[model samples]
Structure formats: structure tokens, C-alpha cells
Target chain A: MANMYNDKVMDHFMNPHNVGELEHADGIGTYGSPVCGDMMQISIQVKDDKITDAKFKTFGCGSAIASSSIATDMIIGMTIDEALELTNKQIIDELGGLPAVKVHCSVLADHAIKSAIYDYAQKTGKHYKGLEGFDPNAEEEDHHDIPEEEE
Target chain B: MRQVYLDYSATTPVKKEVLDAMLPYFSELYGNPSSLYSIAAESKDAIAAARKQVADLIGAGEKEITFTSCGTEADNWAVMGAADALKNKGNHIITTKIEHHALLHTCEFLEKHGYDVTYLDVDKEGRVAPAALEAAITDKTILISIMFINNEVGTIEPVKELAQIAKKHNILFHTDAVQALGNIAIDVKELGIDMMSMSAHKIYGPKGIGALYIRKGVRISNYLHGGAQENKKRAGTENLAGIVGFGKAAELAGNNLQAHIKHTSALRDRLIEKVQAEIDHVYINGSMKHRHPGNANLTFEFIEGEAMLLYLDMNGIAVSTGSACSSASLTPSHVLSAMDIPVERIHGTLRFTVGDMTTEEDIDYVVSTLKNVVNKLREISSVSSKKGW
Candidate 1:
């Protein structure tokens, strides 16, 4: 098959940005697993309703790791509200384009950022109306050995 | 830099001798083995010799070995043929959960046909206990199919003991020894197995050809219809060139079994020791002693297998992983899951199988490359955050 990823995905995957943790983080969102197809942990440094810094650690396929890395760069320096508005499609689009199967990984990245923002809100006793329905503990149901591509 | 291949269990390059043996059957000596001519006689005789070569590797009678398209075909015939032939006797079949997809999918196929199949679980080491098999057997049990060597984990099953259990209970036994051929020794006669499947590609032979050893007097209905080829049991014209390659490869395997084992296992052992010493949170998978000497299956904690695979590939090192991200399924390996390994750990599973051509330099290079790759992935995986390292 053709190389599923474009040049931009390869670049981010080969040299991911913001790869470490903050000594003191405003919020944390972890998703996926080494066992699961994609496990990503996103840490954000929030300052006065703005995401001053963003970093991620990912355990997944090339596409997944690239998604997490690119997602972190996309959210950095953006306000918390702006980060919340970032969609998975936008994250994928920014990274050129991810394979159709790997679009879920980008979604994981977007969800992780939102989930982190939610963590910050819950801790600081602030409410974001958009995240009212969001459960920080809830995740997209574990696939449990099911294939995305059914024969 | 020369690439180092450590995925021999996946497949091997055809040996020069084997390829040379096959060339004649393809271009020059090519003839219909069944035709009534001297040229045809040569093809028929070569095929007969090939059968014996294959049979000799496993210590079976020449007639017991029936050539097939490939290992999957052999396995399919074994499971489907036994299940169909014994339907009148019983509908229940017993097999381990760690079998290749060939057997697992075939059993699932049988389930749809009103056949009952018991998918037995494996231990943490990925071995199916004979006691487990004995207990699962009942009046409805007609056949027991288990893999001699697991393709992913490299765990060697108790095929002999399991076959004996089947015999005492008057049931036929089948084993997919595709991964076992050439790498491990087998004596089907001594093991008392009713049937066993093998493939050539894994043994430095050509692909598209393999063999199934069916014990004399065992009743199995023909799998393919039409042609009178293969004793009218398996249809279609023979794959002469491929079969010829398989025979020559089998002969080499028989002659070099001990040396091959010692050489591969030494490199495998050293690689495992170095990797464990150099890396942390990495545990070797499968039986360290009972497993194939060439296989080193390991899982690096908190790093995805596919990511590690990509990095190794960049370094010109070939390896395999059980992670679903590397396959179309996008699911973890059924074999690892069947071993009851936590799903999280299963994502990092990797298999590095050495072969005859592997060298100390190659092993060292792979060790260094693996250390570099796994460390990079784990560094990115945030193992420090997970463990407060």
C-alpha cells in the first residue's frame, strides 16, 4: 500500500515537539494505552485563561504519536477557549492529512486537550458551559479487541 | 549498513541449494508428474523424493506426507477435513486459543456450520496444559488441534503429551507445526500425532508450497475437488518447483538441525540478555528454555510496538510486533490476549527471531538499535511520568 501518512505527519512523528512534562502543571489529560492503539497524555500550563504551554507523551502508532505531537504544537500559545474550539479535523488538517483509519487518533488528541482544559476548570472551581456534559473520567469505550476494518 | 533480519519465524530467504534444486523443475525438467513419459517420470520421482525428504524431517513414512499449497492450506485441511470426516462421530473439536489465525478462523468457520469448538486458554507462558485439554474432552470431542510452536510468542506447546491424551481417548490429533519446522525438531511417529502441518517459507524453502503429514489409516475426506493429484485427496496439479525447493530445504534442515539450533539460540540468548540488561521494564515473553532457541519475544513497558518497529526499520533492523496498530485489524494479538497478559502490556509486544545467517555482529547491532529505538519511544511515551522516574 502507499505510505498512508503525508510528509507533515512524518516530520512531526520523527521529531515531535513538547515531549516532556511540566514540574507543576495546571491540568492533565491522559488517553489510550500502549496496549490500546493510542495512549496519549497531554499536560498544559494555563495562565489567566490562556494555554501558555502544551506538552504530550504518546504510546501508539506513527500516526498516533504524530497526532499527539502536532496536537500539542497546535494548542500551545492559544487561549483555553480557543484550544477548546480546535476540532480533530482541524488538527488533522494542520498535519497535512492522516490516513482515514488514523482519524480517531487525532480525535483522541483533540479530546485530550479538551479533557485537560476540563481538568483545569474542575480544579480551579471554574465552569466552562461547553464542558458541563464532559466527564473527565469517561473515555471512548475501550475497543476490546475489535478491528476498525472488518472483513 | 547491511540490514539485519531477525524475523525468521515470519519467513526466511530461500537457501541457494534449495533454489537451485527448484530451478530445474521450473524451466528445464518441467513436466506433468502424472504423464506417461520418461520426462514425466523424472518429475513424479522428484516429487516422491521430496515427500520423503519432508517426511524424514518429522520421522514419518513418505506416504504420510501430502504436499499442499502452503502451511495455511495444510492447517485448513487438517481442521476442516477432520471436523467434516468425524462429524458423524462427534461435532465438538478442541484447540488452544493461541493457535495461528489459520486454525482459529477455521474453527470459527466451523462454529457457523453447527460444529462445537472449545477454544482453550493458555498460561502466562502461552502454553496449553495437557490437563486442560484432557478436561475439555468429552464424548462429543472428535479431534484436538493445537499448534506445536506459537508464531507470535514462540512458545512450544506440549504436542506429544496432548497427542497421547487424544490417543487414550480414541480421538485424532492435529498440530500446526508451521513455525516449528526447521527451527525445532519433530518426530511425529514418536509423538503419536494423527496429523501435522508444515510450511516451506519458514524453513528457507520457497513459499506457495507446504506439506501435511497424515498418519496412515486416518480417515480424512479430500479437501479439494476434481483432479486425481495427491492421491486424489488434495486436488489440483502439483507445485513442482516450489515442492522441489521445499524438499531441498527439508534435507538441509535435517542435516543442519543441531548446528542451526546452537547458532540461532546462542545469538537469541545473547540478544535477550543484553536487551534486558540494557533496558528496563522489559520482560521476555514465552518459555525461555522450552521455546524455540531462535525466538526472543519481549514487551517493553509503556512503548507501542509499532513505534518501536518504525524506529528499528529506520536502523535497517527487521522485527515483528503483536500490536494491532501494525496490522489491518488495529487490535492486539489474540495469542497475547489469550495468555491473559494485561491489554496494556500487549501493545508493546515484539518478536525477534534469529536464523542460521545471524552473526554476533548482527546480534550486537540489533541490540544497540533496539536499545536506541525502545529508549526513544519510551522517552516519548513518558515512562518517567508514569513511574515518577
Candidate 2:
């Protein structure tokens, strides 16, 4: 009740764009886990060093789904380097803003794009400046697994 | 959009009668109950009458009830009070893992103070086994606190049988009956329960008011001390309006207990049946035979609970979820977790509780909306296809 989503977040959640797996995807990246209660997968189709299409599949809350939806939409038609440059803050800004607690969803989106780019780089044996020292399996910052106080 | 409320276990709307009974207390009858005057006498009489009304609902004596800020406070008083009073005798308390945080946290607090606490595991249906309880009892066990009904899964525990065990051991028994007060018929004497905690908001009464039933001769230490209020045990100026509303609600609940149960159960069963018929891979949580009449907790496989809840909210249907994403703590419901439900399934669980105001049409709308929500979420879910759901 404390974190009512803005209309933009709700819009993407209610009618998310680019939802589902992309056929012949050049790169697919999955982030988070079901155990953490939020998991997302982003599939990208690249052509001539540019992202032609982007899609997502998510098992998570409204904010996570919304973040994935907006992030996918934002990455389309951008060069691989531009797509990799997408940040969680930009995703939050694109969706107007998300709840403070749900900011991790956007962070997951950021890692998801970078992870897909990392996969793409690995597949083509191409090195990109943005891929420097990016660890896909790195733990998220302050993942809120805090248990609620008993009533 | 049609707004429908199906979260009665969380709280109920105050009834008109209860509201009407409380209105005068906020203005004309605002005198302190402790004041020595005619106006104070009116307040005193009102509180006394309310105490009797609440007492009658649970078949307890008027003198046994003490008003508190809320059910959480009552639960705190019961466990903490009993612990302090019996600390010299014993330092051990036994409670189920499925208890609401109020009791669980109180026990935890006692543990921090060097008391040895045993958190008894509940069965798959969220029912505490009497044998496990008996086995856990030790020479230092002074109190046994268990919930009468689980708030999330709606499983009703065997309070009578468990209380008998505690009585046999000569140990005090307290029940967090907040969810059971109006939903079930409770006779403290018949159940041999030494203490019970109840909330007004859960029973179609005003909030910020609850009562702890302490049976005669139960020597629990005072929860609060400042003045002679609450029979010199709890010392606070009474919540005059809230007490009146609770009393009226209790009286009405007692009078309509049978009809309320029949109506809410009918709605709950219809919702569950309809959803199961329309949706695939949906399973009810907890025991249907031994559950709160209005509660229907179901796990929708391969889909998360918060997504379904938000989708339903878009259609003007309000419900609750046990999923970690929806909770402030980011941890799934402790009640469901204690029942050994799989972590994934726990994230997929939704709790729908019908009440006096819920109607057949509302249930139908929920079922139809839920079907779409579940199907939509599953469509975008990565896990659903893997499970062939």
C-alpha cells in the first residue's frame, strides 16, 4: 500500500510490450531467480552491430514486468553499445519511476541487457568496451530479503 | 469497473450498528471512565456492558476480559505477561511455527531474555499436532501459545485437544484467536484455554481496540501499569468509541454466527469451486474440512501471486498474496513456509477471504478475472511452459 505505482508503470504492466521469446535470438540473458521472487529473461536479435528486436519473459511482480517491458522497448533500434549503456536509473526514469523497494527490478533489467550483450560478445568473439569486467553472476546490491516484523 | 472486496481476514468494514453505537461516545459520552461523576458513570456502564457483550461471544465471564490497543497488544500481553509471571517457575514456552508474528515475536523476545522457546512445526495443512506439542513440553515449560486459526491459509488448529494437553501438564495455554473470534464458535471454558487474544477490526468492528481473555485465577503479570484502569492491570484511558463499536459488533456476531458462517462458507466454496473448474494447475492450500469458513488460499502453478493480485486489482477486485514481492519484508508468508509448501508454490499463493458483504456476483467476477490474470501471467512466464501448465 505504501508504494502505489505511477500510471506509466501500471500501463506497461497491464499491456507490456515485447513479451515472449524471440525466435533465432542471437543472445539471451536471464537474471535473478524464482527463489528471490523475481526472474527475467531478455532475448535480443542483432543485425549489423545494432539491436533489431528485443523481447522479454518474466516471472515477477508488476514492477519487474514493467521494467522488463520498458527496457526491451528502449533497447530496440539502438546499437549494441547503446543498448549496453542502458542503466537501471534510465529504466526507472522511462517508467516515470518505480517504488524504492522495487528499484531492484530496474537493476535486474540493466544487468539483463548487459548479460545479453555479454552473451552476444562471447558468441561472435567480438570485444566491446562496455563488456569490460562485467560479471553476470555478480550478486545484486542489497537485495531486500528482509523479513517483515511480526504483527 | 466494479470494486469488490475479498480480504476479510485482513480486516472487515465496521457494521452500521456498530458505528451507530460508537457515535455518541465520541461527543456526548466523552467522560473518562475513571472519573468519579455521573458522566463517568455512564462511561463506566458502557464499558461494563461492552465487556459483557464481548464475554458472551466467547462464553467467558465479564471480569475475565481486558481491553488493549489492538489484537497485537493483547497477544503481547498474553505471552509476555505469562512469561514474566511464571519466570521463577519456568523459562520455557511452546508455540507453533505458524503463529502470527505477534505471538512468535513475543516468544522471540522472551528467548532473547534467556527463556527457552520451542517452535513446534505444523502439519502440511497448517495444523499443529498434539503429540508433537506433548513431546516438546519439558519440566521448565510454563506456557503454550498457539493460534486458533491461521490467517493466511485459514487452517483451524485443534485448540481443544492442544489445550487439554497443556491442562494435563498443568501449563498455561493462550490462543491468538484474532481470525477466529467472529468466524468460529469459541468457548474458552470448554476448550480449557487460560487466555485468548482477539481483535475488533477482524470482526466488523472498529480498529485500535482488542481484548485479552484471562481466565479467573490466571496469575499473569500486568501488561501496563499507571492507573486503576482495566481493573488495575492495564492502565490507559479506555478507547471509549472503539470499545462500544467492538461490543456492538460482538453482540451482532454472536447472534448471527450461524448465518454468517453459512453465508461466507457458501461464497468461499463457490469461488474455490469455480476457479478450480475454470483454471488448470490450481490447488487449494490447507485442509478444507478444518478451515475458516470464509478463507480460500490457492496456489496457481507457474505464475507469481503478486502479478495475479495486481491484474485483479486492475479489474477492481482486491485480494492478498503470500508472495515475497508483495510483502514489506520481501519474505514469503511464514505461515505458508512453516507448512512446508515449496518456495515457488508459496510465491504463487493467493488468499481470498469472503465476508458478510461478499456476494455471489462478486465471486463470479473474481473467478472470471482470475482466469484471465492467471492465463496472461502464465503466458509471459518462463516457468509455466517448462512445467507444461
Candidate 3:
């Protein structure tokens, strides 16, 4: 893994932030499939429509682990609008990029965040246009192409 | 940092003695064996000697061995070639779902070429049931291909029983013994195996060389078609150095087989015992009691394999996993999928194969480091054993 991943990926993988659940959090989202053996959960505390806190649990590869770590950290103190705007590419770019095969992990991380926000909106009985028609478990083709990723 | 490589099933460093035996073949005695010069006789005789050594290891006749480029080629020739030769008798093939991609993909390719294949399923222990073997056999079944030991789970198949069944049905049986060669006892005659595949690199010989043992009177169509090499069966100039190294490795492995197995299995068991004792929600894959002496596969729950593999690599401990994160696909290993081990376990699985050179200190260091790695990953895990799969 040392040679396979960059320093940032290893750093986040080794020492992830906000690693546990937020008890009675305003919103929770879980993504990934048992068939692929990658699962992630995101729990957020919302205050004034702002994410006061966010934590995560990931059951995936280094890319997924780091993706979850950074995704949760990046969303703290962010308003629902700001959190929804965060892209998988931003997480991957911040982590110095993942192997081509592992880029899906970043997507999974993005899915977890949206799912969490969706959960928050549903509990508050308010629907966010950002999550309109978004399926947490379905694979999305909305990948932000990084020049670094080749087919 | 100390290096502890536990991926012997992937390949091994060539031994010093094998290197020494092959050096002369590379330069000093570098004559083409097909040439009719007295100098070239050295190459011919050397090849014969190597064949004898390899034959001695498998307890087969030296004349029955056909040196191949590697285990894949050996496997390719065994399945595709046998299918071609026996096309008149049958167009159906029988194999297990847990085979290496060499067999699985070759069988698949054959299927695309109008061959019918029956993929036998394994039990949780990764053993192909004899009943399944018998049931899959038909009048058009030309060959039954199964691996002696699965590469990923290290589970040993009932090759002897399967071979006997194939014999009873008058079908040829081929076992890919790539992972089983030096670690397990094999007697082709006694096992009633019609053919078997073996690689040099797995037994501390040079890479790019292997041999397929075709039992006497069993016929297979030629794979490579150029020269009249390999008794007009396989063509191309021999991999002279690799063949010599393979012979040396085979002789060394044959002579030291028991000692090698005992040493590796001892370290393997200790590693297993230590990890299980120190960790929770860890499960061993396949049948522990009926596995290769030096192999262990386990899953530390709630963690994906790539993360664990990377962490272990950082700790100077090399292991492999079922994660396809290394490849372009996110699919997990087929072997674990076939075993029906929970998907989480399959994604979290790690494979450790102790080699002849692996020592107690290496295994101990790995055990200690692994205890921490598993715990640390579990600590950061969003899901635990509590997370239902």
C-alpha cells in the first residue's frame, strides 16, 4: 500500500478524522453493496441548516477509507448547499488522486454525503432539489473527469 | 525495516543453488540442443537430466514431460490442446468454479469456440465434491480440469478421487499443480492423474518456465506450432537456462519436500493461531484441516482488503487479498464468492503463504504487526461485526 498510494491517501487511511457515529444525529446515510464488499455510513449533525458536525464509518479499500475521512471532514460546518456542492473529484484531488481502479471509492464517498444530506432533509420534511431523483445505492454516471484518469 | 514476504503462491526468489546450476547454461554451455554438434549434446543431456529431476518430483516418466513457457501455457495446452485432440470423443469439459483464471478463462475461451463446459461448485471448504464431479460427467466429456490446490484459499481439492472418477469414465484428468508442487506430495501414477501443470517460479526456480506432464498414451494436440521441439508437440527454442534452473529447483524441492513442508506449516500455524487469538470477528477462509501446509487466508471483519494490504505493506509485511481494487474491476475474488463466505468477509480477506525461507522471526513480526493493523483499521471502521451484511 505504501508504494501503491500517495502520501495523502496513506495519511488519511492511517489517521482518519471523525471516525465514529454521531448519536441521534440529524441525518444518516449508508451506501455501497454487500456484493462488492464496500459499505459506508455517514452521520451528520445539522444546526441552522448548517452541518455542525459530521462523522463516518467506511468498510472499503484505502481509497474508500480516505475518501470517507476527507469527505466527512470537508463537510463539517458547511451548509446543506455547500455540502451538496462538494464533488468526488475535490476529495480525490485533495488526496493526491487514487489508482484508476479505485476512483469509484471517491464516488461512493460523494454518495454517502448526499445520502446524509437527503436523510437530514427527509427528517425535517423539507426536500432539497440537489437530491431530486438521486438514488443512494444506484451508480451514477455523473463522474467529474480528472485528466489524470485514463479509460 | 525488515522484509517479510508472504506471497509465495505468487512467486518466489530463485534459490542460490538453482541460480548456480543455470549460470553455465546461460553462457558457458550455451548451445542449442537441436544442433547435431557434440557441444550441443551437453544441452540435450542437460535437458534430459532436468526432465528426470522434474519427473522424479511428480513420480512420472521423464519422457512424459513437455517444458512450457510458464504455468499459464502449461494450463493452456492442457485444456485447449486436450479439447482439440479429443474433439471426436467429446466437446464437453468439467472443471470447478474455484480454479485460477488460467483454467477458468481457458475453459471460457473454449466455450466460446463451441465447447460445452460444466463448472462444478465447491463447498464452503473450497473442495469440489466427488458427487459433483460424477454428476457433471457425460458421454461428451473429454477432459476434467481441476486444480490440486486453489491459489487464493489454499484449499486442497480431492484430485485423487476426481482422477479416479475420470479414469472410470475414460476421460482425461488435468490438475493445475502450480501452487501444490513443492508443498504437497504428488505421485501422478498413484493419483491416476492423466496430466498436471507445474511452474518453476513457485518452487524457487526461474520464472518463464514450467512443465506439463502428460501421462503415457494420453494424446493432446500441439499448442505452439513452429519448430519440431518438444517431440513435435510444442515448438520454439527451449528456455535453456530456465529449464536447467527448474530442474535444480525440482531436485532440491524433491529432496527437501518433507523438511520444507514441516518448516512452513509450523510458521503458518503459529501465524494463524496468533492472529485469531489477538483479533475478534476474524474468520479463516476455506478448510483449515484440508489445506496446503504453508497457506492461510483470513478475513478481519468490517475492513476492506486493500486498506489492510497497504497498511501491512507499510509495516514491511507483504500479503495479498481478494480485493479487485488492484485491478480495473471492483469485483472481489471469485474463489471467495464461490465459497459463499459473506461479501464483507470476501472483501476483507487476506492471504498469507509461508515459503521455505520464511522464519519464525518473520512470522512473529508479522503476527505482532498484524494484530495492530487489524485493530487500527477496525478502530476507524464505520462498520463492525455489528453491521449486518
Candidate 4:
């Protein structure tokens, strides 16, 4: 079976479209593992609850690299609330459906967004309402973006 | 693009002649080897002939060979059965930390059952010294199981020296020769091996069939209990077609042994030379002097192994970070860890194994692809570190 991730993902991974960290960023989130062969470090610049700028560096499978790339593209123009609502399923759908085993790559992308938001909340002393007891293994549709009864 | 397969240590494609010999058994002459009819009698003869072929490969009597479902099962039977039988003799097992999971996990299982296991450490070259084996042995040491050659780093262990030591102490020694079977020369008598495991898939026979070599007059208990097959050592109906294929493959391997070794060793050396010439901050994993002829494990610093694998796959060049069995495991290799490789480089390790079919062109292609991939990953890592998010 030919592995699915094509040149777009390979191009980004080989010469990552936005390779490097953000200086004086609003938030930064890194996920995956060097041991497991997939890692993503994402930085976000948020203004007025909307993502003004986003960039990423991922070390992983082609689909993982592409998923992170496509994810940053999807979230850059959206509100923090919109990006928080992004699902791994949606990412797979967007990329023409990843192989069943490679579905974890999509999940890594979803977690990167949440991680960045959590970082933002940590830096600014605002509650990360999007990450209230987030269970990474839970089905995408079951988890809430923000808990209904936040203090 | 011409692709290369450098994972022969994982498994090999069935040889053409082995396949040809096996085709008729699966169809026209399909009959139970145990049945007492004309067709069944012919099946019995084929099974007997296969037994002789496999025995000849390792220089054992046909009665001493017990076929199993796979190498893992053979290993389990050797460890578990022997431990159970010799409970009164000793409760201690000695093995190296670099053993494949087949022996490692079984030793762990035995440990849980109150058996004392001393996991001997290896030097940076992935070789467990014979002196370590000599020191580890005690009156309570019932068995000592080490691999003939590592499936990961491909370093040939000091099995002969260890076997001689085991003999002096009268300890039953077993070697997992699954990866070493056809690629290298092996004679049970020559090495004084008491019990050894062999897998057919690794020798270009067929999958789902392997043999365990038990030296004559060595009494070990049975793992599977059923029909009086395999001299009542192992049970279940014989996989006749697989067994026959294994025999033919073994015969072919014996005939082409020297040529295959010379070709694979040269191709592997070419790959190593190319990598060393083109790359920097890389180190070979196992001992250069005592390694397998076909195995080359190199660790490229900075980049992760999985990312490198993805990049290589993109270019249609296949290799591995470790053995095929443990490829998905998130932990840095236990084998590499035992060798005390640093965490940074462990993530970057890649195993490139040559096979009978591998050529100089295949090695060059892999070298070029690897050079390109490493440079790219390193470039990204450097830029990302500087920005400091």
C-alpha cells in the first residue's frame, strides 16, 4: 500500500512552510514525541480573541506535517473560539481522509491548537476555558470547547 | 524510481524454487501427513524429506527438530518448557539485555513466576562478553539463552564461547538464531548449541513456520500438548507446504551461503561508507568488527527516526529504525539503551539491512535519500531552536 501523504506534506516537512518559533508570542504549544517520531511546536498571535498570526514546526510523518500545516492555515484567520472547536475528524476530512493508523496525526494537530490556547491562557493569566479537563482520547464530538459553568 | 528493501532481517520474500516445490503440496497432493492412506502416505514422505533438509541445514538428526508456528513460539517453548522442567534443578536464567522480545518477554514472564533472571549488559558495540556469561552462571542457573546475531543492530554475539562455558558448567544453552539462520553459517554441533530457534520466513521460505533445533539426548518438556506429532514435543497438524518450503529454502541457503554473505556484506559496507562520507554527527550502533554481514545501524544526530523513515518512504526507499517488530514502540530501543547510547542519538537510529536481492544501486539510492532527509530535518531543527518560541 502506497503511504498517503503526498508532496505538499513532504514539502512542508522537508522544508517546512513556516519553520521556527515565535518570539514574544501570545501562546505556544508543542505536542507529540521524538521517541514516537512526531512532534509539533505551534505558536500563535491572538488579538481580541482572534488568531492574528500562526506558525508551526513539526517533526513527524508526512500526514502529520501536512496536518499541522493545514491546521495552522485553518486557524490563522479564525477566532480563538473557532480554532478551539476544530476537530481531528475535520482535519482528516480536509486532507481527503488519512489512513486509519495515521488518524493519530490528525489528533496531534487538534492538540497543538488547544496547547497553544492553553499557553496563551497561562501567559496572560486568563483561564484556558477551552481546555477544561480535556481528555485527548475522547471522541471529538463529545468534548466541549468550553465548559458550560466556568467560574 | 528504483526502490530498495533493506529490511530483510524483518522477513524475506519466498525464494522462487521454494515456492515452486510448495505449490503442489498445497493443492494436488494436499493430505494429512498423519493419515494412513495413499495420498496421505505421500504427504508423510514429503514431510520426512523436509525434516531431513532442515536438519541438514543445522547438522542435526531429523528426530531432534521440532517445527513450530513461528520463531517466537519456538523461543517460548525453549524457555518456558525448560524452566518448567528444571524447576528442581534451578530457578535462575541468564540472558543479555539485547535479546529480541521473544526471549526478553518470556524471561520477564519467568521473573514474575519467581525465577531469578540476570539480564547481562552489553558494551557500546552491542556485544555481551563471554566473561560476563561466565561470571553470571551459578549452580542454580538452569538455562542461558542468547541470540546468535541481533535482529536490530546485527552484532554477532559470542555464542560459541558462551556455549563452551555452558558446557563446562553443564548448563543447557539456547540461542535464538532466527535472524542468523540463513544469512550466516550455522551448525548445531559446530557451535555446541543445545537448543536453537530458526524461522522460515527469515530464510526466504514461507511465513508461519519455523523450527527449533534440540541437540540429541537433550530432554526438554513440551509446550503444546496434542496429537503425537513432532515426536510428541510440539502438537497441532504440520503445515506441510510451509515445512517443505522451509526445507527447500534452507537447502538453497546452504548452497548459496558464501556468495550471499559476500554480496550482502559488500552492499552493507558501501552503504556505511556512503553515509560516513556524506553525513556528519553520525555513529554506527554496533561493533564494526563483530557485526552481521548484512546489517548496518547508524544513528544520525538531531532528527527523529520516524520523521526520517517518513521522508525515505516518500522517496520509495524502505529501511527501519529498529527491527520490524518494535518499529511502533515509542521507547528508544532497549538494545540501544543497553549499549548506553544517548537519548538524542537514539531517536535518530536507522537500521539498513541488506539481503540476497539487494544491489549496489539500491545502496546508493538509500544513501542519497538519507543524506537529503537528514539535511532537511537538521535545517528545520536549527532554525526552530534559534527562534525560541
Cα-based TM-score, every candidate: 0.95, 0.96, 0.94, 0.84
Model 1, which residues run further than 4 Å from truth? A33-37, A47-49, A105-107, A123-132, A142-151, B385-389
**Per-residue lDDT of candidate 3, residues B1-389 (tens digit):** 99999999889999999999999988789999999998799999999999999999999999899999999999999999999998988899999899998899899999999999999999999999999899998899999999999999999999999999999999999999999999999999999999999999999999999999999999899999999887887899999999999999999999999999999889999999988888888889989888998899998887778888988898888899986554445566889989988766787889999998899999889988988888888877767667555
How many backbone overlaps does candidate 3 show? Answer: 3
**Steric clash pairs (candidate 3):** A1-B310, A57-B382, A58-B382
Local error of candidate 4 at residue A131 (angstroms)? 11
Candidate 2 has which clashing residue pairs, if any?
none
Off by over 4 Å in 3: A125-129, A133-151
Which candidate, 3 or 4, has the higher TM-score?
3
- Give DockQ for candidates 1 onward, in order: 0.52, 0.57, 0.48, 0.18
Stretches of model 2 off by over 4 angstroms after superposition: A134-142, A145-151, B387-389
Q: Candidate 1: lDDT over CA atoms?
A: 0.86
Candidate 4 lDDT by residue in tens digits, A111-135: 8788889888878887655678864
Worst 10 residues of 2 chain A by lDDT: A142-151
Number of the candidate with higher TM-score, 1 or 4: 1
Cα lDDT, model 1, residue A28? 91
User: Candidate 4, clashing residue pairs?
Assistant: none
The Cα RMSD across the true interface for model 4 is: 11.5
Tens digits of per-residue lDDT, candidate 1, B1-389, equal 76999999989999999998899887788999989999899999999999989989999999899999999999999999998898899999999889888898899999999999999999999998899999999999998999999998889998899999999999999999999888888999899989999999999999999899999999898888988998888889899998889999999999999999999989999999999889888888888767987999998888778778877877788999988777776767888888888777787889999999899999899888888887788788855435732
Rank the candidate models, highest TM-score first: 2, 1, 3, 4
User: lDDT per residue, candidate 1, A31-82, as tens digits?
Assistant: 7554455767899999988888988887787888888888898888888878
Q: Which has the higher lDDT value, candidate number 1 or candidate number 2? A: 2
